[model samples]
Each structure stands twice: as structure tokens, then as C-alpha cells.
Target chain A: MADVKDVDWDAVMADSRFQSLRRKKTIFLWVLMVFSMTYYFVLPLGAAYFPHVFQIKIWGVLNVGLLFALSQFVVAWAVAFCYERRASGQFDVLAKEIVVAFHQQEPRR
Target chain B: MRASRAWSSVILCVISVLVALMPNVALADATVIGGEWRALTLTVFAAVIGLTIYVTYRSASHVKSAADFYAASGSISGLQNGWAIAGDYLSAASFLGIAGLIALNGYDGFMYSVGFLVAYVTVLLVIAEPCRNIGQYTLADILAYRNDPKLSRIFGALSVITVSTFYLTAQMVGGGVLVKTLIGIDYEVSVIAVGVLMLGYVIFGGMVATTWVQIIKATLLVIASIVLVMLVWVPYGFSLPDFMADVVGDPKVQARVAALLGDSSTVMTPSELGQRFLEPGLLYKMPVDQISLAMALVFGTAGLPHILMRFFTVHDAQQARKSVLWAMAIIGGFYVLTLILGFGAAHLVGPAAISAVDAGGNMAAPLLAQYLGGGRDSFWGNFMLAFVSAVAFATIVAVVAGLVLAAASAMAHDLYVGVLRAGRQVSSGQQVAAARVATLIVGAMAILIGIAAKGQNVAVLVGLAFAVAASANFPCILLTLYWRRANTAGMVAGMVVGTLVAVGLTLVSPNLTYPLQKIAAANKVLDAEQAKRTAIEAVLQNPWPQSESLIVKARAEQVALDKAIRLAQADIKKYEGQSRSFMGLKEPLISLKNPGVISIPAGFLAAILASLWIRDERARAKWSELYVRQNTGMGISKSVSH
Candidate 1:
């Protein structure tokens, strides 16, 4: 690895592709974080405040509460899958390009 | 080769000592296992130990540098590391505690399982890739990359040791208790055995052996859970409808459900009992408690040192990301099965029988295994019990090893090398040696504390560990990574305030003892009256006093006894609320058991306000370097193979 001072981090930070990568990654992560946090909190709040709503049975012994709890597992997995796809498919490529471009500019280092 | 020989000798010494101690300890026990099963379970436990030793020796030969000791030389694949992460995260608490909690509390218990899995989402999306890109060995490396190195390493090591030690002791104590109850091992002996085994893994095998141990344990645990779930469903003909029918319609289940409800006047029907059990608010009546605990679970995991260290074991940021995804899948699936296991125990084993063996219901999984295999007298039942017991033992040992490794790294790598010998030339050989010594010390201390805290409530320690991680470590790491203005002052202040507020709130919260002076005074008066009644009853029981004076005295004593009984009853009625709040207040100072809801905001605020209040040119100038490195993985350290 090259020294920190030799890398010209400021130039790399100002690059358009790197900027785009950060923009897209941050926005996608923020959305998922917000959605998941809201969905996670709802389990405790909904179950505690509205017990009767959760108590309404849907199938045999399975109720809305149980279904909602189980759905959290699905939503969490889905979020992970979506992020993996986006990150590996797009973000990783942009990151690789940015690294390669930087290396080309500082070939001596 | 010489070191390998020395390790083998040490291993042999430890094994011989344990073997010598077992017979004396076994004689002292009210052994839980009977007849041939006792020897069978012991043999299985021996096999587990033998396998650990074999793996440790294999990795011991490969551990040649600090990287190998601290991060397994970064050769572990993404999928393998994921299993290791799951192994570290899924402690005995998750396997046994949650299952037992669900069996007893129904929906409320299952709520804990969901939060535990969803916690990984926060780790995956927010923390994983960036952490992998920036950090070399510990979380301190990330902070030191941009901020003040000495300050960051010091506070980082402090928080890591704090979180890991508390968690370590809790797991050790839990292991001792579980082993004693399930397999009838002495508590002290079990704690020492586990502690020694953990040290062997961390000191000799280092991270490589620890990772493999975790992977194998995780596989075994998952397979065992699947088998248990299948057994629970097989009797229902592998149909969900049939299972649900029996769960709600079975007379035995209804009886156990009613017993849990604790309402004796009206006998609730099977369907009604099932509905009540399926609904929430049974164990946690307070909504705030529920929210507070959920917040801690979701955010706290991202800050765990052991979990974060797993990222560095992978080759690159992409592998790190992949590993988190794999962990989420395994952990999520495991939790989902816990729901079935919980209800299965309730229906098949009955809460009555489950709690009868262990009041905490921690033995639910093992007991369920026994029933599923056949019954107590059956051969398969005994085998399943032994198998589950061995798995629980492996789970505890694997988790403690991960924790000891994390704490040892903080001490040796972060504290000794980064802070104590700052800017000094240190050899990799010295670093590895220091880590081994630290592991031995930390592991031993945990064993001692675990034994001393034999019957203490472990829930408080687990809660405090999470609270500290979420409030102290999480904020500092997050801000250092993203906030450009995060300076030395801000980082230090954030950690100090975060840790203080978390611990302070927990101390004042209802999780600890509240002053009940009034109840104590009331109890004093009640005791006096009861003692008077007992004295009068003793005098009245003697019929040999035939004299007129003696008869008169006996009659007077009987009259006094009546008054004493009346007074004692009145006093008991007056102070019926012994557990009422201090100073006659309706609630304690802080009602929330978990302090995340308040302390987490406090931690973040402390960091932001301090950063905005103070300015540092050096920190501001380094932000771009960290940012470029974090986003694009530039200039990150490559894995050391030699």
C-alpha cells in the first residue's frame, strides 16, 4: 500500500465517478436504513399499543402479530439481497474503476 | 515445530488435570443424567474437546505473524466467515434463553428473536463495507485513520474491553449454569474448563482456529435446530394446519397455557388460551420497555467488537459485504425456527414440565429434544439430550473464544502497540506474544468472575453490555467515519458521556434495586406481631399445667395469641405492596430497562455538539483521505500471507 500523503486523496475525492458512486450508495443505504428502522420499531409499538389488532387471528392459531414478526425476517433478508445486488453490480464496479484510474495517474507510486 | 510440541504438552497437562478433577466433582453432584447416559454425555463432551485441540494444533502451526493471530491472515472466505459470525453472535442465550423465553412468554418472547436478526441489517447496510475498507484489525484503526491516534486508540480499547468483558463473563456464567443443570457438571469446574478451552483457541490457534470452531459449531447448531423443528412437526403429519390444530385444541396444552396465564377463577378454553398466548403484552406490559429493548438490539450489534473484527478476517470490502449477507440469512433462518421451537415446547413439553426442571425454562430445548426423541426412558431421548447438551457446550466455548480474541486484540494491538508504545518500533513477534499473554489473562479473569457471580442475574450484565456498545462505541465509530469535524475532543467526550449516561441510567432504572424503606419498616412491624403469636402458641400447646394459676395463664396466653394473630394479619394486609416504588412514587426515576432510547441520542448529540464546538485543522484535512478510502477502498492494507 502507498503512503497516505502520496495518494493525492483530494483529487480522487473530487472525481465524478467516485462522487456518483458515493451519491448512489449513500442514497440507497439511507432508504433501506429508514425503511428497516421504521418497520422494526413498528413491531414493538404496534404490539404494545394495539394488542387487539395484533390479536385478530388470520389462520388458526396464527395472528397478525405472528405474521408481522415473521415478515420482519423476510423484509430484512430482502433488504440484504437488494443491497448486495446493487453494491456488487454497480457500486463495486465504480469503486474498481476509480481505483484503477488513480493508479494510472500515479504510476510511479 | 518446537512451539507445536510445547502446545501439545500444555494441552495434555490441562486434559490430565481435568480428568483427575472430574471424578471428585461427579461424586459431589446431584447429577442430572442417570445410568449409562452419564458416561455417554461425558464421552461426547470429550470428543468436542478433542476436536477443539486438533483444530487448534492445525492452526497453531500456521500462526506466524500478528495478522495471523489477530485476523487469521485474512485468508477466510466470505461464506466461512459468515458462519463464524453467526457462531459468535448466536450465544447460548439466543439458543436456549430465547427458546425458553418464548415457551413461557409466547409472542413477547418471539419479539426478541426478530430484533436480534434485524440487527444484522443495520450491520450489513451501514457498517460492514466501510468498516472493512478503513479498519485494519480493530475499530480503533478506523478512528485513528482520521482523528487523533492516541486518543482514538485509548478510548476505543477501553470501550472494547468494557463491552467484551461484560459479555464474556455473562456467557461464562451462563455456560456454567447450563452445563450444571443439563449435564450435572460442577459450576466452578465448568467455568474453568470453558475458560481454558477458550484461551487455547485464542492463544494457540488464534483467529483461524476460532473461525473454524465457530463455523463448525454454527453448522451443528443449525442442523440440531432443524432436527428439533422437524421432530416438533412430524407428529402433526408434517402439515401446518394439523400442527396449529393440535397446538390450540390439545387439552394438555390448554392446561399448561392456563397455568402460565395464572388466572384461576375462570378456566379459559383452548382456543382463547391459544389466542392470548399468540398475542403480545404478556411478559412486557410496558410499551416503552419494549421500544427501548428493541432499539438496543437493532443498533447495539453493529458496535460489538467481535462482530466488527470478523470483517477484517475477509480479503476485501466485497467479501466483507458478502459475509454480512450470509450471516443475516443464517441468523434470520435460525430465529424463525426458534418461533416454532418455542411453540413446540409449549405444546409438546408443556411449560409446567419445562419450568419444573429449570425455573428459567432454559432447559426447554434439551427437554424438547428428549420428548421428540422419545421419552426420558428411551434410548434416542437420552442420545438427543446428550447431543443438545454438547452443542450448548460448544456454543458457549466458541462465543467466549471470539470475545477473548477481540478483547485481547484491543489490549495488545490497540492499547500496548498503538497507545502505550506510540511511534515506537515494535516487532510482529512481540505483538503476537503480547496478544497471547493478554488472552490468557482476560480468559482467566472472566472465569473467576463467572464463578464468583454464580447465581447472580446475568440478564443485567447482558443488558449493560449492549447498552454500552450502542451508546459508547457506535456513535464514535459512526461519526469518525462520516463526520468531517470529528476531532479528538469530540471522540473522547462522546465515549465518556455515552458510557456514563448508559451505566447511570441503568443503575437508577428499575433493572436494579430501588429503595423500599417504607416496606422495610412495615415488614418490621409485621414480624414483631408474628413472633408474639408464635410465642403464645408454644405456651398454649402444653396441657400438663393443671393448676388454677397455670390454667389461668394458659387462657390468658390463648387470648393474647388471638390478638397477636389479628394484628399480624392486619400488618400483612397493610404492607401487601412490598415491591412498590421508593418514596411512594408511582414509578422509578427511569422506567426503561434498556437505556438505548435515551443514551444513544445522548451519545450522538455529544459527538456532534463537541465537533461543532471545537475546530481542528489536522482532523478536517484528513477527512478526504478517510472518505476516499472508505468509499473506494483505496490504500487499504493487503492481507499478509507470509
Candidate 2:
């Protein structure tokens, strides 16, 4: 194994494929994180401050708070599924291309 | 005495078998052994344990190399690894504690489940694939990869050991409580038994055995939960409303609720009962603690060594990503059913019965199982109890094994091989041996501490473990992967500050400190009363007194009694007010039961601020390479058999 300092990281970072992949993943993760955190924080905050509203029954025997809590499970799965599809379909292709380009530029000794 | 002894033996046999079938039960008495349930429970328990041990024996042969020992040679597929991850993550705390909490406190308990399940999204989006792409064996590998390996190794090892040990203690305590309650054994004995079994699995079978055990346990727990839900649902015509109505209408349950509201004569309407159960504020009277707990749980999952290590068992980063989704699906479904189980126990068994069994309500699930089966002495009742208990037991064993493996790897692989040997060319065989020895040492420490911590609430310790993990380990991992400027000094400072603040706050938090003060106050009151009684006795010359002197003494005694009663009432009021405060302070230094709200940001700030001062160009340059590799999975090590 060679020292990591020897790798041409500047060239790799400059590659359009690497930059594109990084941007897509970062944006997707941040959006999903903010959405999930907001959704989660709302339950306790709502129950604490506006509990009477949360206690109002939306469906037979199901209240606003219970519905809100249960929706989080579905939302979490949907986000994960979307991320998986995006990664395997689009990101993987770009990643493979970058790997191939790097190897071609500096062939392993 | 002879009759009672005979009855006890009969109960023991059934309990032992049920103990084999299920690992936890909160209350056991003479009535538990009255019928065919005992025989059925025993038989099922035996079969479960037999199957578990057999799986361990079968997997032992494949663990011939260090890679195999640490990661099952990355032979596990995504789906299998997902179930294994669930098995590893869901401990007695989730299965018993959450359900019990919901039974006692309504909506507040279910909040814990929501926080726990949502945490996986963070794992799926940010940590999973990147962690899998970067390292092997333990979390320390990734932390040390780009920076100074020696310093990273030291900090990583310390954090991993600290988090794992805290988690281990919680699981061991749960195990002891389960064994004592179900099998009627001493708490110390139960702790030692669980510790020894955990050591056996790690020392002999390694990750192969551990993974299989987890997979089996997870499957069993899910199945048991589904069965319990069905049983509870069927009688209520599969309508949640009907089931809840029955719970609200039960005379005993109604009485319990009236007592909770401080009005014995109160008769609550159906809507009011529903409102109380569905809304918060029953358990978390102060709302800040609720949000703080959620913060700890959400960020905490990313830092737990055992959970993080599971990603390595799969083949690649893609599988790692897939595994998190699969885990979320299974775990999410199981939590949904916990509502049914919790409410069912509260309705069918009643709060009085639950408290009689265990004040913590940890036995709600198992007791509910027995009720659903056909009451305590019926064949179905015994069988259901045994099965649930077996699954709960498996839950404890699987979680503890994972924690021990993570801690031992940190001790042997990171500290012994990486730092002490300076990454020397030690044989894989020798490394495997060192890990086994470390497992024994770690296991022994957990057992001793667990014995010492007997009867302490399991929930508090579990929460503290999450806070520590989130504060200390989460920031270092995130910064190391993302920020280019983060150096050895920043990582060390973040870990030290985060760990000290979290642990220090927990020690002084109302949960631990207030209880000690209350006990001390009670002892002082008792001593004062004893001294007063002695003085009164010494003042009297003879056993019998004249009427005039007796009347005079009685009047004085009445005055003292009134004074004492007033003092006691004041003490009770003061203690209630100070229950959530620190050291008789008007307001607590750490207001929240969980310290994550403050500690997590403290960690990130410390890391970022410290990094700004120390510029390491080498580490900064290394970041691009780490980022490229982390994103693209290029030049990452493929799983190789030694």
C-alpha cells in the first residue's frame, strides 16, 4: 500500500462527475434531514403547547397527535426508498465513470 | 412449609422452562404454577435455548480468521444483515420498557419509540454507506484513516469502550431483572449467568455466531409481537376503538385513573379517557425533557458502536444502504404494534396487577401474553408467556453480545494492535486470540457492575448511554468524514469535552442524585423519632404511671406528634418539588432528564472551533481523497479471506 498523500486528490476533486455526485447526495441528505427533524419536533411541541388541538379526533378513535406520530414511519421509509433509487440509478453511474477516469489518468504502478 | 416447598418446585420447573422460552417476567408468585401453563412454558423455553446454542455451535467453525471474527467475512447479504441489525439494536429496553411505559403513562411512552425509529433515517442518509466504504473491524478504522492514526486510535478506542460499556451495563441489568423475575433466581446469579453466556458466544463463535443469533432473535421478537397484537385485537373485533373502550370501562382501570387524577370519586367520560391516553404530559410533566430525549435518540443511533459495526458485515456500500432501509421497515412495523400490546396490558391485566408484578411495568408484555393465552394457569397462557419470555431473553443476549464484541474489538484491534504494536505485521490468528481474551475481560466487568447496579431503573441508564454516544462519538465521526480542517487536536478536544459534560451532567441530574438525598432525609427522620422515644422512656421511673402524670405526659406527647406530622408533611412537599431539580436548587443546572440538547452542540462547536486554530495541511489534503472514496467507493478494501 502507498501513502495516501501521494494520491492526486486535487485532480479527483476537480472532476465534474465527482462534484456532481457530491452535490446531489449532499442536497438530498440535507433536505430529508430538515424535513424529518421538523416532522419529529412538531409532535412533542404540539402536544406540549397546543395539546387540546392535537387531542381533537381526526378519525374514529384516532386523534391528530396519533396520526402525526404514525405518519413519521411512512415518511421515513419513503425518504429512504427515494434515496436508494437515486443512488443506485444516477449516482452509481457517475461514480463508476469517475473511478474509470481516475485509473485511466494515473494507472496503478 | 413442606406444602409451600412442593408448590415452589412445581412453579420452578414451569418457570425454568418458560424462562427458557422467554427471558423476562416481572412478577412471579404461587399462583403462577397452578396449571398446565407451567409445563408448556418449560417445554417451549427448552426448545428456544436449544436452538440458540445449536446455531452458535454451527457458526463457530467458519470463524477461523480475524476478518471472519470481526465481520463474518462480509458474507451476509443485505436482507439478512438488516434483520441482524434490528436484532442487535432492539434490546429489552424497546420490547419491555417502552411497552411498560405506555401501559403506565399513555402517549409519553410511545414518543420514545418514535424517536428511536426516526434515528434510522439519519443512519440511512448520512452515515451508512460512507462508514461502510471507509473502514473495517471497528469505528476506529475510519476515524484514524486520514488523520494521525495513533491519536485517532486513542480517542476512538476510549469513546467506543465508554459507549459500549454503558450500553452493556443497561442490558446486563435488564437480564438480571428478567432472570430473577421469571426463574426465581438471585439477581447476582442471573447477572453472572448472562455475562458468561455472552462471553462464550464472542470467544468461541465471534461475529458469525453473533449475527445468526441476532437474526433469530429479531425474527422471534417480531413474530411474538404480531401474535400478541392479534390476540388482543381479535377479542375487540379488530377495532382499536372497541379495545380502548374496554380499557377505559374496566372498573379497576377506572379506579386507577381516578387515583392518578387525585380524585377518588371521579368518573371520567370516554372522550376524556381517550384524550388523556392519546395526549402527552402524563410522564413528561416538563416538556423540555421530551424534546431533549428525542434529540439524544435521533443523533445517538449514528454513534453506537454495535449498530455502526453491523454495516461492515454486508458486502458493499450498496448493501449497507439497503440494510438500513430493511431495518427501518421491520423496526417501524414492530413499534406500531407496541401500542396494541401496551394498551392491551393496561386493560386486561389492570394497573394494580401490573404494579404487583413489577413497579416498572417491564413485565406487561409477558403478563399480557399470559392473559391472552387463556389466563395464568391455562395451557395457552403458559405457552404464550414462555414464548414471549424466550424472545425477551434472546433480545437481551443478542444486544449484550453485540456490545461486548464492539468493546473487545476496540480493546484488542485498535488499542493492542494499532497503537501498542504500531500497526506491526501481527498474524490474523494472533489478533483473533487477543480479541477473545479481551471479550472475557469486558464480559466480567459488565457482570460485576451489573450486579452492583441491581434494582436501579433500566430506562434511565439506557437514556444516559444514548446521550454519551451522541455527544462524544457522533461529532468526531461527522467532522472527520466531512470537514477538511479537522485535525487530531480537534477530535481529541471534542471527545473529551463531550464525554465529560454528558457523564458529569448525568451524575448530578435529578434522576440519580435526588433519590439518594430522599433516602438520607428519611433516615434522618427515623433517627430523630427513635431518640425522642428513648428520652420519653427514660423520663418514666416505672412501667405503670399515675393517671395525673400520664395525662400530663399524653398532652405533651400530642404536641410533639402534631409537630412531627407537620414536619413530615412539609418534607414530602419539598421532596416532590425537588424531584426534578438538582441538590435542593430552585431550578436544576441540567433541566432536562437527557443532556443531549446541550452536549451535542457542545461537541460540534468544540471540534469546529478547535480545528480553526490548528492547521494541518496534510489532513486537509487527505480530505478530498477521503471524500472521493467515501462517495464513489473507489479504492476501498474488498472483503478477503485470510
Best by TM-score: 1
**Lowest-lDDT window of 10 residues in candidate 1 chain B?**
B261-270
Q: Give per-residue lDDT, candidate 2, residue B309.
A: 92
Clashing pairs in 2: B17-B42, B18-B41, B20-B45, B21-B45, B21-B390, B22-B389, B22-B390, B23-B389, B23-B390
| Real contacts recovered, all predictions | 0.91, 0.68
How does candidate 1 fare on TM-score?
Answer: 0.89
lDDT of 2 at B219: 93
Best by lDDT: 1
Model 2, B1-642: lDDT tens digits are 342344335434544543563333324432333333455655676677556666777777777788988998888889999999899888988888888888877777777689878999889888989998888888888888777888888899999999998888888988888756754555776676567666666777799889988999999999999999998899768987667667655644544444344322224453364457666777787778888888899999999999999988887888998899889988898898998888788888876577667768888898898899898757787778888887887788789999999999999999999999984798988999999888988988998889888866556677878987898788888888887788777888888888988887776666655633564565565567766565555545546664543433433443444455556656566566454433454333655688888888898888888888888666786788788888887766553335
Tens-digit lDDT string for candidate 1 (B531-571): 65565466556666434433333444444345445555664
* Cα TM-score of candidate 2: 0.86
DockQ of each: 0.73, 0.55
Error of 2 at B243 (Å): 3.3
**TM-score against native, each model:** 0.89, 0.86
TM-score of chain B of 2: 0.84
Off by over 4 Å in 2: A1-7, A105-109, B1-39, B263-271, B513-589, B638-642
Using DockQ, give the best candidate's number: 1
